[model samples]
Target: MNQQRIDGGARRAVFAPVDNRARVDAVVRRIGDAIELGLLGDGEQLPGESELAGQLGVSTVTLREALMALRQQGLVTTRRGRGGGSFVSLPEVPGEERLKARLRGWSTEELRDLGDHWAALSGAAARLAAERTEPEDLVQLRRTAAELAQADEAAACSRLYGRFHVELAAAAQSARLTREQVALQTEVGALLCLVLGDGEYREEVSERLRFVISAVQDGAHESAREPAERCVRESTARLIALRLTL
Candidate 1:
C-alpha cells in the first residue's frame, strides 16, 4: 500500500468539511486529531491554502486563521517561497505527570459516562462494520492492530489504539460515525497512554482488536460488537482505577 494511502479513510475524514458554526476551531481540531492519530504523517505537506480552504468548505480567511493557531501550537509549520506550504509537526505526547494531572480533573462518574458512550459508539460501529464491510475493507483495522501490538512507546500504542476504533467506524461506511469516533478519541486518547503503556495491557488490547476484526470478517455482527465494547470498557475501567488512585 502507498504510505500516503495507508489510512485513506481517516485522511478523508480529517479533511472533510467542517461544521459551519465552528469553522476555524473545527479545522484546527480535525487536523490536530489526525496528526495524533497518525493518520497524517509528520512533515507531510498539506494542500495549498486555496485548495485546502475549498476542500474544507471554508473561506481562505478561516483556513488561514486555523493554520495560524496550529502554527502557534507547534502542530503545523509554514515556509516561504516555491514548494512552501504548511507541513505537519507532530506534537509530543504529554508527559506522564501532565497526563495524570489531566486525568485527575475528571470525576469517576464522568469517566464512567464517557466510557458508556464510547462503548456504545464502538459497539455500533463494530456491528455495522461486520454487516457492511468486506474482507479487503478491514485492511486498515488489521494494520492498526498490528502496529499497536508492536508499539513500545505509550504514545504510539495509545494513538494506534484510538486509530483502530476510528478505522472501525470508517469500515462501517458511515462518515458521521467516523467523525464522531475521531472526536471522541481526541477526548480520551492521550489519557489512554496511562493504561496502554503497560506492555501486558498493550498485548491484550492488540488481541482484543484482532478478535473484533475476525468477528467482523466472519460477518458475526454480535460477536464483533461484544469485543469492541469490551475493549473500551476495559480501558475505561483501568482509567477509572488509575483515577481513583490520584
Candidate 2:
C-alpha cells in the first residue's frame, strides 16, 4: 500500500470508535470557564491528557477533541517535549477604544440592560470582597487605587480603571463571581469610554474610584457596594444621554 493510503487508514482506525459531540462540548465549556475565571492562569501547565480525560469522565479521544477546540479559541496551547504539556493562554484584554467601537451598534435599550446586569453583579462583588478579602488582596486593591490617582492621561486612566475592577473581582476569591464581574465590567467600560471621552468625565470617574477604595478599606461592605452600583448606573445614564444627543 502507498504511504499516504496507509496513513489515512491508520487515522481512520484511530478515530473510528469515538463519536460524542455533546460530551466533547461540555468538557470544552468547563475548561473555558476555568480559564475565564482565572482558575487557570496564562502559561500554567495543564494536567496530562489522560488525567484530564479521567477527571472529566470522558474518553481520551473526546478529551483530545475538546482540547483542540480550546486551542482554536486561543485558550490553550499544546507542546510535545518531555516537560511540555498543554498550557493556558491568557485572552487579550480589549483596549478602551476598541471596546467602544464594538458598542457603537448597541441600542439604548440594550445599553440599559447591560447596565442593570452590571449593577447587580458589581454590587454583589463589592459585598463579597468586603467580606472575604485578605490583607494581601486589600494591599493590591490599594495599589490599584494609587495607580488610578496618579494617572495623568485619559487613556492611561481608562486602563487603570479597568484593572481596578479586575482587582476587586479577584479580591472576592470566587471564580464564578469574578467571571461574571469581568464580563459586566468589559461591557460597562466600553460604554463609559464611548460616552465620557473627555477630561471632565475622567475626573468624575477618578473621584468615584477614590470613594470605592475608601469604602473597601474601611471594611464597610454595604458602603462599598453603593458607590460601585452608582458608578454603573451613572455611566449608563451618561451613555444613554449621549446617544440621544447624537
Instruction: List model 1 lDDT by residue over 135-241, tens digit each.
Output: 78989989999988889999989889989999999999999999999889898897898898899999999999999999899998878899899989999999999
Question: What's model 1's lDDT at 191?
Answer: 81
What is the TM-score (0 to 1) of candidate 1? Answer: 0.64
Instruction: Give the per-residue lDDT digits (tens) of candidate 2, residues 186-227.
Output: 445534555446767767877887777677767778888999
Q: Lowest-lDDT window of 10 residues in candidate 2? A: 94-103
Residue 72 lDDT (model 2)? 74
Per-model CA lDDT versus the true structure? 0.87, 0.73
For candidate 2, report its TM-score: 0.55
**Count of backbone collisions in candidate 1:** 0
Runs of candidate 1 exceeding 4 Å displacement: 1-94
